[model samples]
Target: MPANIKALKARIRSVDSTMHITKAMELVASSKIKKATARMEESRFYRRVMEEAFADLAKTDSPYSKTTDSDAPRLYIAIAGDRGLAGGYNNNVFKQVKAAYREGDMVLPIGRRAVEYFRHHGAVLYSEDYTSSEKLTSADCAAIGRSVTSAFDEGTIGAVYLVYTEFVNMLTQEARTKQLLPLVPDEGEGEETHTAGTVYEPDAETVLNALIPEYVGGITYCLAAMSFASELAARRQAMDTATKNASDMIDDLNLRYNRARQGAITQEITEIVAGASE
Candidate 1:
């Protein structure tokens, strides 16, 4: 066989192996995305309810509804994926966070990638408890909420924002930065029309204070779920593209290998005939 033919064959084999790996990754990501999206949907419903409750509270004279001073420092809770190979999933969120970052601001990174990115840039880290996206739980979010709420209560940070990827669909994921603190009540068309008339047990202010942490935790968990879904969707799409490209390369390499092999055989036969005639 010709050396070119051998090299082509090796290249085809390498591509075939890569194709298999990418196909498997695609399947895994597909499965994970389904679960992540389902969880995201459920969390979104709960978050909406929490938001409505907060909006009603904001209508009253509760202290939680009061806006913080503009000069107060900001705290950003950034959510990213723990692993890479998910296209631009992590990068998008990080870019949004970096763009909005300012001096004296603190960062609470949720995933390992977020932690690393902020730490490398010398951002002040709030807490390192929740570092893995896959293993995040309500308890983890609650802890994070408590930490930020503590800071806000102590006047350490004035405003709080959540930086994460919003899962629109498999084909579309958007990085978003949303304010989380001071309980900005939802307004406009999406706001709930009917306000409950139920009275608070003790007082509205006390209830608002107690519900604020829970609401924050719920929103944190919801955003994390959405980010996870977006990550899986991006990974699935990337792996699928890689697998298709590998398949195309292997087909081209196989064609070249066949032509090289046929050429080598024809040359050998011609040489044998010439030598015999001589």
Candidate 2:
């Protein structure tokens, strides 16, 4: 065909390739978001059960109450992502953690992103690097829970708090701070009021001591699920935007190609008609 048509074909091919890549990215993000949402759903039950267990434990008196004291040296755990592209999801929590730091606080960063971010400004007490999201397990939470409890017992640290993004909905995820130490009563507004008479057969302090570690596991699991959900949701939104932008670009290129082809065809027909008249 004409030179202009040939050039247009090449341009179209390039745009088609770009569109394929964006479409694939969108599909991948969509699948990940589904799994992440399922995980968030599963963890909700764990949070509710743990809350009930804690309420039961808090009804009785206990000697181990020292675990919840605020005057103790605080242990702060910050959860973030290892990779980016989810917009401000990780950065929001990182900044919140930095702003919340108090004098003589110890920090344990869960993801490499947070580790690198905090290594420069805060005291890095511990850093955990994972190979993949699947490799992160409840056992990791248990181990960290034990270590934090030991620190409190040994007087190395006093309180513990976690900074993460709470997934409220697909459109809304808020950076939040949660208390993990002290096994305090879940007395916050909106907390369900359970009948205290259920009887902790073992007494309040004993039940709390038993439930405290479980609460730690629950909190860690909940945080991880919420953070992952937020990441996936953000990625899905980003990929969708990219896919739309690519489609618009392809349409513009096609219009230009068609106009150029029409101009070339008109010139050739005009030349043929002039030759016939001569």
Best by lDDT: 1
Candidate 1, TM-score vs. the true structure?
A: 0.90
What C-alpha root-mean-square deviation, in Å, does candidate 1 show against the real structure?
2.2
Candidate 2 residue spans exceeding 4 A from truth: 1-19, 55-73, 120-123, 129-134, 188-196, 253-278
Candidate 1 wrongly placed segments (more than 4 Å): 59-63, 189-195
* lDDT, model 2, position 267: 86
TM-score of each: 0.90, 0.75
Error of 1 at 102 (Å): 1.6
For all candidates in order, the CA lDDT equals: 0.85, 0.73
Candidate 2 clash pair list:
60-204, 68-182, 73-158
Q: Best TM-score goes to which candidate?
A: 1
Least lDDT summed over 10 consecutive residues: which range in candidate 1?
189-198
